[model samples]
Structure formats: structure tokens, C-alpha cells
Target chain A: MDPVGLSGYLTVGAVLFVCGVICMATKRNAVGVLMGVELVLNGANINFVAFSRHTALGLDGQIASLFVIVLAAAEAAVALAIVLNFYNNHLTIDVDRAVELKG
Target chain B: MSVPELLNHVLHTDLPRSVQIFAPELVLCVTIIALLLVRMLKWHHKFPTSWVALFGTLAAFVGVFAQFMYMKTGGELPQMRELFEFWGLTQAGVGTAGEYFTGLLVHDPFAVFFRLGLVLFLVLVQALTILTGIPDQEDGQDFYTLMIGATIGMMLACGANNLLMLFMAVEMMSVPSYAMVGFLKGRRLSSEAALKYVVYGAGIAGVMVYGVSLLAGVLGTLSIPELGSRFELLMGDQPFSLTNPTAVATALGIMLVVVGLAFKLSLVPFHFWCPDAFEGASAEVGGFLSVASKAAAFALLVRFALAFQGSGEAIQTLCLIFGISLGVVSCLSMTLGNLAAYTQTNLKRLLAYSTIAHAGYMVMAISALMVLLSGSADPVDSAACVEGLMYYIAVYLFMNLTAFAVVAFVRNETYREDIEAYNGLSAGGPMTKLLCFCLLIAFVSLVGLPPMGGFFGKFAIFASALKAGSVHWFLWVVLAIGGLNTVFSLFYYLKVLRAVFILPSADESRTVEIPGFNGAYVALITLPILALGMSWVMGDLTATAHDVAAYLFH
Candidate 1:
């Protein structure tokens, strides 16, 4: 039987990270960009948890992933609140619409 | 030891001592909680939330002051002396004093000094906010809550020992600032600044966390001190070159972390949000963000940089590359910041660019420190670099707040934000004359003129950079660019003074009225800039800075 190895987990994490970066760069909606941030964080979380399986990392990686999850939640909450406030004033979620403070 | 026994041992032994050492931060946390509870109480309406916040911050300052005195005077308090002996926290030689909260934070001289500076700055900023009346009675709770919350985050950032703590501390500081920038409801520019800040901040933070994960995974630890040894081990017996896969990976991780820190520090290429944020937010909030956040970020950068030290050949090579890169960053930030400030007409936006320029000056100290470290020469040169950085922050706290306080005072009367509005400011009554006089002093000091604290600060940094250049010639270029940027910065700051004193009043009918007491407030903050400039008056701040630098290696 074929077994999934560390390289497979790493490859998946890399793909998730690339996708998240692209999402963040291309998305115009503030909320959509926030979702991209979540994806990026979760990709890192996957790598952390995967590394926890290694003997050297032991439980620290798992503990780090847990911390990442909690932080990501806090970040998302703050981002959403800012987006909601932006929408309340601008009447749109598009980040481009909020451009009063240009150089 | 069994796992349960270890847990029990930590719970009993470490927790109590950690709490004692972290009393100042705990006071801040209690302030936040108490603020919320007070808001819930009906009496909050009668007693202004500003008073509550003022008292809370003062109490925190007292705690920090007590701790600082204890450290400075060899534990004059009996309780502190006992505590230090019991926890093995006393400085036997001059490295890390102790680890607190099980190594999530360190109780070193560097951290303690920075925490003391941050709390002191917070008290001053709160006083400015109250004077400017930016947060009125009705919304004072929300405003003070966020301000205190953000300050707590910054204090933590200065002391963070673990990667997780670093990331969380930065985010905690940033989140509240984003809200504060947008707190002016219905203001279009304010909301825009908040949006820009949050989006850029979140993206940068995500990248930094990914970097942290990669570094931790490869190194098998999140503790900063562990990274140095692990790095030496990972490059064992290999030729010192960037082509090595491990070095490449580690560099990528570090550069990612640098990106996030640079954004916080508002280095160019990442400084787009800074001017806009300052322009949109009130001068008071801008003052807080500029001074508090920058000082804390500088501390974090110093800590992060020092944590990568090792005597191995490969480590030396990596540190050299890192130092050179930071030198380049310092050059770019200073040159770009000064050039950009030349075109800015809005007073707040101009000051924002000036803040970026000063950050460049501060980063020069870091570059020198790094260069000296990588060379593995005399540690005194590197120590002087840190001293210069700390002294700059100390003076900058006064210089910048004075500028912004004047701006806020003028805005209250004239509602004018552009430079042209300052025409004939000297022509106004006694209060306006006093404000103009204060502004002149602040701007002159900012230009690093002799007799102002900024001059000595810049002198210390440039001297350190020259010492570094004597070791590594690339730092010469950093020193040259710093000199050139100082000249460039002088032009624009003088431009403001010209508008205030030389030019005719743009409008004849409008008279800006300032209360007489406000003159005293302006004087109170601005006098320090003048005093710090004179070496004889302030004595040498370098002694205190040396104390901080002694703890850097650990």
C-alpha cells in the first residue's frame, strides 16, 4: 500500500499558500481579501500540524497551530468589523471604493 | 520527571514569579477590565472616562516606575530584593535576567527599559488626547479602552520571547490602531485610512505567520534564543553561501518577517499607509501611533536581530548579508522619506513623512549594531548603536508630540491643515505666539540642530555607523546617505517655520484663539526636546542605553 509522506503534506500546504496569495492580490472585495488571509493562515496551520508528526517538533508544532487558529479567528473578527464599517460609509464592499486618502 | 509533575511544578513555582515580574502588564490588563466594568456602572456618566483612563495609566506607570527603580538601584525595596534572589532573576553578569511566563516573555533589562518607555509615552499621549478634546465625555470609554489595549500590545511586543508571542503582540497592537484610525464615524477619509491599514496589515501579518511556521518547523522550536543554536547546527560544516537550501529557506523566512516589521515601522515601499493614516486620523492618534508603535517595533527588531547571533562561519555570513540589507533599507527609507516630505503641503501628512525619515535614522543604529555583531569585534560599538537608538526614541517622543499637539491646537481654532494656513502664526496673540515658538523649537530639534536632543541622537547613530564603516565599508554608504538626508530634511522643516513667521496671513479676518493654559501644556512637552539636546543638562542617556544593550545578547 502507498503511504502519504511529509512531502505530500508540504506540497498541499504550498498549493494552499500560493492560492491564498493569489486570492489576496486579485480580490477587490474587502471581505474576499480577508478570506484569502484565512486561507494563507490555514495553509501555514497545515504545515505546522504536519511537522508536529516529526519527532523533533513533538507537541510544539501542534501547540503553534492551535495558537494560529485562535489568532486567525481574532484577525478575521477585526477585519470583518472594519469591512462592515467601510460598507456602512461607502455603501459598497469594494476596497477601491474607499479611496479618499490617496497621496 | 513525569509530565504531570512538570506541569504541577511549573504551575506552582514559575507562575507566581512570572506574575510578580509582569506586574506592570497585569496592571494594564486590569485597567482594561476595570474600564469595561466601569463603563457598565451608572456612575461612569458622572465621572469622565478620561479620568478613569488617566488614573489607570498613572497606576501602570507607578508599577513600571517602581520596577525601573528596583532595577536601577539594585533592588532598593526589600520585597524586590527577596523576589530577585528567590527566582534567580538578579543580573550576575549582564545577559538575560530571567524568562517569564515560561519563556513567552523575557524579564531582561532591555524589555524592562522599553516597557518603561512605552508606559511613560502612553501617559503623555493620554494627556495630549484629553487636552485636545479629541475623545469627548460620551465616547471616552471606547477611545481610552482601545488606546490602553493597543499600548498593552506594544509593551508585549517589546518583551516577546517566543515567535507566537511576537505575532500575537503585533496583531494586538495593530488591530486597535485600525479601529482607532476609523473611530471618527462618518468621516470619509478616516474610514478609508482604516480600510487601507487593516487590509495591508492583515496581508503582511499572514505572510509573517507563514514565515514563522516555516522557521519553527525547520528549527523545531519557536523560542528566539533556540533559533541561533539551531541555525548553527543546520549549517554545520557547510561552505558559507546562500546557495545552500537551508540558508535559502531560512533567509526567505526571515525576509518575510522583516516585511511585516518594516510595514509596522513604515519603511518605504510599505509606507503608503502611513501618510494616509496620519492625514485621516486626528493628530493625537497619529502622535500615539508614531511614537509608541515605532519605539516598540525598534525594540522588537533589535531583539529579533540579536537572537540570530552565533560564532559559526555560516552564521557570520548570514549576519553580514542581513546587516548589509538592513543598511540598504535604512538608506532608502531616509532618502525617500525626506524627498517625499518636500512635496507635502498638509501639515499632518508632512509630519508623517518626517516620522518615516526618523525611522530611517533609527534603523541606521540597527544596521550598525548588526554589522558590529557579525564582525564579532568589540561589543561596545554595538552597545553604542543601541544607546543611540534609545536616545533618539526618548527625544523623538517629545519632538513629535510637540509638533502634533501644536497642529491639533491650531486645527481646533482654525480648522486648517495645510501649510499655507500657518502664515503669520506669529502675528496672533500671546497664546498663538507661544504655540508658534514651541513649533519652531520642535521642528528645529527634528532637523537635528545642535542644542536639541535630536542632534545628539543623530550624532550617536552616525558615530556608530562610522565605527561600523571602519569595520565594513558598506556602512559608509549608509552613513553618507544619513548625512545627506539630514540636509534634505532641514529644507522642509524650515519651510514650515517660514510660513509661520515670514509669510503674510492668508486670511485677514480669522483669528485663532488658544487658551492660556494650553501654552503651559505646549511648553511642558517641548522643553524636554531642548533639554535633551544639551549633553550637560540631561547627562548622558548612553549609560541607561548601555544597560539595555547589555541584555541584548541573551
Candidate 2:
């Protein structure tokens, strides 16, 4: 298999997407869901570089992906902080238990 | 030829300009590394580590300012400066001469402006961290390290010119933020918020990756400059044989990728996590997410939109659709955000809706940019919109901070964020009353009313839209709706205002005690809310925006 082609990236992306779905489905810990984010980003990244190689996305695809990474970090930070605060009032970070928010 | 060899060749041509363009952020990188090394040393709780981060941010601010001045000084030859950043870049990078990393990244007014924005936000967050002091439960050392680490990622995001850089920058920033969010792991809601963010984030990332793969498969290269060269060709051609399969699959992929980015911006349909996350989080955390994260995401949106603009390709057309979709989503978002805000009494949730509405405002700007992308190149392309977004976010930071500070103050006494909890707040608490008034200014600004920084920012954006959207009445009507949404927004923004001031005090006889210097920290954020609105200090910001627009749209 030639290492630098479309199928390669497509496969990587598919694997990542599936993995993230599974992670989102299975994760009970708040931080574990965040791990899914890391995996998900890695999946997109593979696609970005793949495109950088095979298509006219050129640098912009890569650039857009890069911005995505930065934002994910900012989002994670605030999200984690909020989660911590939530636990300060509650005792568990179980997704199922967050029902107190349902007013 | 191989990728590296080809990239090297491109780099050779870009070197001279690259050095100048990369200077501002490069300066921050050096300072950040130095701070990291400094933090590794153990001092008797007297190392003044927070001051170190503050100083670095300020220096980065000064460096970015200098870089902006340098570009404005040398690159003002309107026609030439407008042509390409490679020509106008003049920032003196540190340690060695700076150079472009091919056209993947470039130094120019726009990058300088975003870098400046990052510096300000970094300083803002650092100040909050410093004033709050170390949480009794956590180690202060690693916290600051992660904070600086995340700031570096943001700085890099502003400079990113290609896809690889974008991804790396996002992860670089996100990893640290995730840690920060879980800083209070003992608390369940905070942990839950972190979990929701991660799951949602990962899911969105998957969609984005699939989309990027499709884009790469179809386009052949991820370099935006190269993509621009082939924009018409890629978008204009049918890649998937003599069948409709090509457009269907590729467009779907592109939409998927947008979902990833859209998730970050909390664009309506993908915004399920926002209210809960805001409610579950700390005020500081909420404030940072509401402003900094949005600013960084807008930068990505501008870059992506610009990359695919025109071409009449399905993807380019997809971007146009996304723009309209984003606008439609934003209008609903603002209404939902503001109107829902009226029903809820929890300050954080109200602010959450408020944050959603602002995201809608930004997306609306992006939507307008799409129309501009679809229309002609006259009155310029989407640059005006980008510039408007930058200014809008600048206002958002200060206004949001003021709002959050007030909530933090109230939280200390009552530990409550409910609307009725604010009853008679002004009865005996003088500072709380003053803080409430400042928050009123912030709310007015958020709704885009006059004399505040928010109004000026919105006015500039709307005026630009009127020009770009003029050719298409439908586009104009959509933009008009965006304007109307802001008015409708006022009703909800004021509801919170009423809660803080007009409603009876939650504690009539007892007042919350001020926590030393922390009171001052809350007051300090108000300076920018008033300054940028009054002194036109953001003139440089506004001027620099012209270049940011040109960088992307041109």
C-alpha cells in the first residue's frame, strides 16, 4: 500500500470517527469524554495532512485544522472548569447524574 | 518531487517575508518558554510566577503592538500593501531574522492584530488567575504552566496558515484547557461539564476529519495559497466521475467538517452543551469560554471561509450555504438565547444564553461574509466581515468579564446564581451596586447599543454588510434580520439587568463582604469596557482589521 494516498487518510478518519463515537457512548467520567476529543482531533488532523498531500486544499485545510485545535483547547479548559464547579455543588461527574440541570 | 523538497523550495522564496511576518508570535513563543523554565524552579512561594506570565503577556502585547506599528509604518503603500502580506511584512523577529514557513503562514497586519487580541485575552485570564490566588486544593505551579501553554496555542492559532498548523495549535491549546476545567475534579457538575465538552468536542472533530479527508482527496493539497491558485479549478470541476456521487459525498463531508468547527462556536443546532456547561462551570471558566474560545474559533472560521470563497465549486457553494445556515442558526440562537434568558433566573445560564446570542452575532457576520463570497469582489470580499468580527470579539472580552466578575462576587456570599437571588442587592452593598451598574453597561454593549464598544463594533460590521449584501436583496434581508435580532436581544439582556438592579435584593439586611484585592480585580476589567468605547483606543485594532480582511479575502 502506497503510504501517501486518499484511502489511507479516509481510513484513518473513519477509524477516528468511530473511535470517538464509541468513546462518547461509553465514557462516564467527564475527563474521559475529553479524551475522545483528543482522539477526534487526531482523526481530523490525519485528514488535513492527507489533503495537504492529495488535493487543492493546499495550506488552508491545514490552517483551518490548526485553528480547530486551538479552539478545542479553549473549549476544553472552560468546559473542565465548569465541570469542576458542578462537582463542587454535586458529588459525582456521571453524565447520567447531571439531571439536576433539568429544572 | 517529495513534500519536504517541494516545501523547501517554496520556503526559499518565502524566507525573507516569513521572518518579518512570524516575528510577533515568535516573540511570544520565546517568552513563554522562558516562563516555563522559570516555573520549573522552586521558590518559597515568592517566585512571583503569576507576575512572570503577566510580564510575558504584556511584553507580547508590546511586541505585537510594535509589529503592528512596524507594518503600518512600512506597508502603507495602499495598493502594494493590499497585494500580499509577503511584501508588506516588516516586523523584526527576535534572536534571528524571521521568515515565512512557505505561504502556510505570513506576518502582516491581520496576524499582528489577532496576536494582539491573544495577548490581551492572555493578560485578562492571567490576571483573574493571579487575583484568585492558588486554589487551596490544587498545585499552583502546574496551573500557570498550563495557562501559558494554552496561551501559546492561541498565539499559534492566530498565525496558522495551513491545516497542519491549525490542528496542532488547537490540540496544543485544548489539552491545557481540559486540565484547567477539571482542576476541581472533586465537584461533579464541573467534571460533567468537562466530560460533555470532551465528548461533544471529539464527536465534532470526527465529522471535521472526515470532511477534511474528502477535501484533501478532492483538492490534492492542503496549502491554502496553493488552494487559492486552484480554487476555481477544484470547485469548478467534478471529481467523482460522471456521477452525482461526487457532489453528494464531498459536500456531505464538507458539512461534517463544518460541524466540527461549528461545535466549537456553539452555533445553534450544535449548541446543546452551552447552557449546561455554562451553568455547571465556574464564573471565571464561563467568562473565558464565552470570549476567548469564541475569538479563536472566529479566526478559524474566517480562514476556512476565505480559503473556499468563490470558485463556484460545490464546496465553495457549500461554504456559502454554511454561511446562510450559520446565519439562520444564529438568528434562532440569539432569540432562543435572549428569550430563554428571560425565563431562567440562574446567572450562569442567563449568561450562557447571552453567550449563545453573541455566537449567533458572530455567525451572522460569517453568514454575511458568505454572501460577499458569493457576490462580487467589489467593496472587497469577506475581509470587512473578518475585521468586524475581530472588533466585535474585542468588545466581547471586556463586557463578558465585567458580567462574570459580578456573578463571582454574588456567588461568594449566597453561593447562588438564581435571578431572584439578586433581590435588593443594592440596598446596602455600595460596591455591588457600582458593579451592577458596570454590568449594565456590559449588557448594553452585548446587545450592541451605542457609546459602548459593542455598539461601535456592531455598527462597523453592519455598515460593511450593507455594502457587501447590497447586490442581493435576499442577503440584505437576512442581514436586516440579524440587526433586528440584536434589538430583540436587548429585551433579554435587560432582563438580567433588571434582576441585578430592578429586582428586590436577595438579602435585604445582610451584604456580602468584599474579599480584599479580589474586589479590585473585578473592577479592573471594566477599564477596557469603558476605554475602547470612549477613547477610540481600538483605532489601531480597527485599522489593523482592514489588513486582516485583505489577508483573507484578497
Interface RMSD, prediction 1: 1.2
Q: What is the lDDT of candidate 2?
A: 0.67
Per-candidate iRMS values, in order, are: 1.2, 4.8
Model 1 / residue B446 / CA error / Å: 1.1
Model 1 agreement with the true structure over B1-554: per-residue lDDT tens digits: 99999898688767776776777777888888777878888557878788888888888887776667567766656756654454344333112267778889887777878888899888988888888889887788889999999999999988889988888888889989989988886777888788888988998888888888778878878888788789899899885776888888788888888888999999987888999999989889999999999988898888888888878888877788888899998999999899999999999999999999999999999888888888896877778888889888989999999999999888888888899989988888898899999999999999998988889889999999999998799999999999999999999999999999999897877667788877789999998888887755567566777777765643
Q: Per-residue lDDT for B369 in model 2?
A: 79
Clashes by residue pair, model 1: B452-B533, B453-B533
Kindly list the per-residue Cα lDDT of model 2 for residues B1-554, writing each as its tens digit. 89998777667656545555555456556666666566565442556666766777676676665556555665355554443343234434321222257555645556667777777877877777666553431355466666667767776666666655655666566556656665656666556666566556555655565565565556565554444435456445753332565556555655775676677777778887887777766777777777776777777767666666555555455555656676677677766766677677688888887888788777767777777766655646567777788788888888888888778767766777787777666554566666667777888888877778898888877776676566445556656777778877877777767766777765567765656566667668777777778776868667767776665555
State the displacement of the C-alpha of residue A32, model 2, in Å, after optimal TM-score superposition.
8.8
TM-score of chain B of each: 0.95, 0.86
- Candidate 1's docking class is medium
lDDT of each: 0.85, 0.67
What is the TM-score of candidate 2? Answer: 0.82
